[model samples]
Target: MTTAVAATATAARQGPRPRGLIWTVLRVHRPALLVWCAYVLLMVGWMLWVQHVSGARIRAELDACRRRPEGACIDVMTFSHSMNEGWIGTFIAYSSYGIAAWAGAALVGRELERGTAQLAWTQSVTPTRWLTVKLAVPAVALTAGTTVLVLVYRWFWSADEVLRGDEWYYTDPFLNRGPAILAYALCALAVGALAGLALRRSLPALAVAFGFVLWFHLYLDDHWSELWPMRTITGTVSGHDLDALPASHFWPLHLMTTGVVLTVAVAATGAAYWLLRRRTR
Candidate 1:
């Protein structure tokens, strides 16, 4: 038997087995994982230290505000050294998302552009398996990193109710445990995969992926509930009391955005498959 026939027969005999393509891909790109972890650790430590150093100031301001029942000074939950929710934890979250977006783009975008994808795909691996591994590796890594970020933010801000008032700003529905984060991540991944397959150049793929990510982030930040179907749960502080309310009047938007993300993911993966199959070189 010829080399190709022997390999095909071996593959066939192996049959279908559950595979962790994502892990395999991630192992091949272990440096990305290390960098992701280091970044998360550094951010968490920095935020915590900043918060600790400024804790006295926050308390003093809160005390002063409490003393003056009807004054210009108001009690607010400060994140790190900034009273603005968008400045500290949220900023970190946004940055983390951006990095993840770039990492996703770098996944297959760089490899395919470098012709490494062709080499891997032509192995005993099926196209589906190849793509799955590519997507799975970075997706899992990004998801894990994002999860750490969300947990850190939640833990760090748990003590300060003042920061909670800007529910829309602080919670980052896109980073939360819902369709928003999934949509955002999947959108970035799909764009990267699609761009890599179509453009076949790292720089062009990176440009396209970054452009899409920027547009998506801006759109979601501005019209989250309007375009996402996810409702912002609003909480209120009255006198010395805090009240939590379920103002989740935006479920439809979440569903719509989820559907859009699903469509993009499916289309991008399918297109990549077709493109690779048709390529003669």
Candidate 2:
């Protein structure tokens, strides 16, 4: 009897198994977690390899060309530029679009379509908490992953100007050079969650979310320069003469756009919550 009483006391102190909603969300979406990790690592590793390996090769060829004044150095430089600006840029753009689709279909819509979200709600978790966990986990993960990629990209972008000679106004360089990428990732997540909640169907939500993100990206690409007024330099500049902002003005424009995108994300998240609450009521 004394042993039984002691066991009961211990059980009371230990409490029930700690199966948190956040943990449940994570457990359910572990495959996506792996994918996100792989993508971040791949991009970071590629940039590092380019910066230390391919970039070094290009530099060596340039030095050799300077000494000899003849060789395939121009070809080397051209290849390096294409790899850096063309391939990497395209990968980043597609990855951003993929995030929106994944969030809409795999993260939220599938669960709702399968009635798993309803099952979760019936079990002691509130609808608000359910949706919160859904949004919060992906938001945190996306932000961290995108921020790491941005930092690595920036390092490679500025490391060797001769090898990866990409202009600031280029689509890839412009987007990956600052915190704007993270903002876009978060916006995509929010937009995906909203679409999934509204549609409650995986395929439709995926299509709509991707389309919205694509449109937003295209809009920004066309009008990003107009976000901040360009400063004209009348004097002779070393590069081509064009009406554009100075290099120093890049971050200001990016930050302003980031702010706008993040605001839209917040609004989308708020709307999702309101709609969920109303549906549950």
Q: What number of clashing residue pairs does each candidate have, in the order they appear? A: 9, 0
Alpha carbon lDDT of residue 230, candidate 1?
39
Q: Give the TM-score of candidate 2.
A: 0.88
lDDT per residue (tens digit) for residues 1-281 in model 2? 99999999999999886369988878988999999999889888887777777777777777778877555345756485656756876687557688889989988899999999999889999999999888888888888888888888888787777666678878788888788888888889988998999999999999999999999988988888888888865556776566867888788888887887788889988999998999998
Best by TM-score: 2
| Cα lDDT computed for each candidate against the true fold | 0.62, 0.83
The regions of model 1 sitting more than 4 angstroms off are 1-24, 50-53, 64-80, 89-105, 155-158, 163-165, 169-179, 227-246, 250-263
Error of 1 at 14 (Å): 26
lDDT of 1 by residue, 43-116 (tens): 67765765565665777777777778577774344543454434554555455345434543577667766777
Q: In candidate 2, how many Å is residue 92 off?
A: 2.4
Candidate 2: where is the Cα deviation over 4 Å? Answer: 1-18, 70-73, 233-242
Clash pairs, model 1 backbone: 22-137, 77-162, 77-163, 228-253, 228-254, 229-250, 229-253, 229-254, 230-254
